[model samples]
Target: MWTASAVLPGAGPADWRELRRDGEAAEFHAATEMLELHGAETEAYLHGLTAEIPSLYVIMRETAGECPLEIVQITASPYEAQDYTDSGEEIVEKVPMPHGLVAWVRDFVEEFHQDEIFVKRKRDKKRIDIVEDGVGDPRIDKAADIYASPSLKRRRLQ
Candidate 1:
């Protein structure tokens, strides 16, 4: 079965702990707050945490076959689990995030995360012209010239 856990940083080993699934939601209680997450929202919350916090991570575990358990680290964008998997065997289960953790992640993301805007570069209109003009071979140049000349338009006679 797929299970989710919270890895809290501290001096003690108990800092890393498993979250309990209650009904449709997973819950985690800290000294200050309680986190609960449900359904697909859990995954998004964990992903946000992994992206915003350096020490926080979402782990996908597979408990079968020779490996028994294989752990994969979830990242924000560039290092997604799908990018590393070469075959179906490498696929693992996704776990949900706890409720309190979601709130923490939301706060972290709000404060630290900056969305990157992608700007599409305009294609050069003269690129083909440059390639045709730069060709040194006489045969290729002749063909290009023939293909490009507007006066060579084919006319149909009835």
Candidate 2:
């Protein structure tokens, strides 16, 4: 089983302390403690966490109005903090995965991920006669002109 949590920067220590003091505050707040996942559900959630789009925009309702900001996503099973920004900003803070978690992820990837084999398409053998005898060659003159009929006009009028 894996767990996920969303930590917003705007919700500072003071807000967290208040949330701790009043358990009911958690219901109203965007910050969730931990959400458990299982089986294929875990894999699906993990895929979302590992997606290329790192940061997600979330609407925060304040007394004045609603504000939106990009927030980092964190996962527990594989234990990764994906801090991605759309503005091409470099992420300074690093969240290292534990050795056990790394091994587990590796095993999961090995079991599920399969590399697609590249098979080069075989080229059709060139007809030596076609290359040797040009289009207007006398040898191919006996061949029927399929495009000779006016009824077979290729153009279409809109």
Candidate 3:
């Protein structure tokens, strides 16, 4: 998967913004250093990170505020991941970010939102219907179909 990773330096927000928007590719270490010069908050966030998860990627857009940038993280896990592992990243409407970070990201810049990459979910248009070989009772009935229910019965009223 193609990704963009650019660090914002304290020297120039314009350059960082340009790189973020137009650059084909950028490295993290170089970017991290540039951002550190601008804000302690961003520096601290980077310092806290030990390693990057290979499955996820993020594009941090420079905000108008003093902070480094507003970043939106999303998974790049391959389609085949579902075939191998039963447990996979859930289909999420948005990335899960800490409350404090979310607040910070929004505050750092005005109208901060996720920078999305075009990744479409492809599924074969095949209908999955009820198919069975051996069965105890035919479920299709006329009046009512018996579903598993509570055994307790109501008492008769006087």
Candidate 4:
């Protein structure tokens, strides 16, 4: 289990730092990741930040190259994380957000988040009961009774 212990503020250049090693299990820390916020994604970020735990989602992807696993993304938006999880190869983990980062995200959301107004679309009240031309029951020929099937039409003709 790869757990994010902490995010160093303004740390220069991030790389995997080995934390501890057990018999077979080992822990590596990837630091100095910058979480970018978008104006369009503020709604998603707000939804995630308001959660009881207010956690960040870490997305790890399997690489075909020399590195077996790679840190693809770290997102505050659960929606973004969910998108990555749709691909079975990616591993998504929810890590608890730092208090300072939570506050920072709150400020960003407050500044960018705008309430979208809901407008109910008015449906057309036009009568659809009247059958249009060439839209009647196709089983009956135009020369036969509208209610009659092809068999009935043949019998009537006979």
Residue 105 lDDT (model 4): 90
Worst 10-residue lDDT window, candidate 1: 29-38
Rank all candidate structures by their TM-score, best first, as comma-separated numbers. Answer: 4, 1, 2, 3
lDDT tens digits by residue: candidate 2, 2-32: 1112344334332223233254333223343
Candidate 3 residue lDDT tens string, 31-103: 3322111232332233222224222223344456754454433322222223323433322222233444434
Q: Which segments of model 4 are wrong by more than 4 Å?
A: 1-9, 132-158
**Winner by TM-score:** 4
User: Taking the tens digit of each residue's C-alpha lDDT, what string does model 4 give over 77-124?
Assistant: 999999998988888888888888899999999998999999999989
Once superposed on the true structure, which residue ranges of model 3 sit more than 4 Å away at CA?
Answer: 15-57, 60-149
TM-score of each: 0.39, 0.28, 0.20, 0.73
Clashing pairs in 4: none
In lDDT terms, how accurate is model 3? 0.35
Name model 1 segments beyond 4 Å from true: 1-67, 72-79, 86-89, 127-158
Give the least accurate 10-residue stretch of model 3, judged by summed lDDT. 29-38
Tens-digit lDDT track for model 1 on 51-152?
Answer: 544323343446556433444554332234444454655543333444554566667556555555889999877656445454444434465565453454
Rate residue 75 of model 4 by lDDT: 85
Worst 10 residues of 2 by lDDT: 55-64
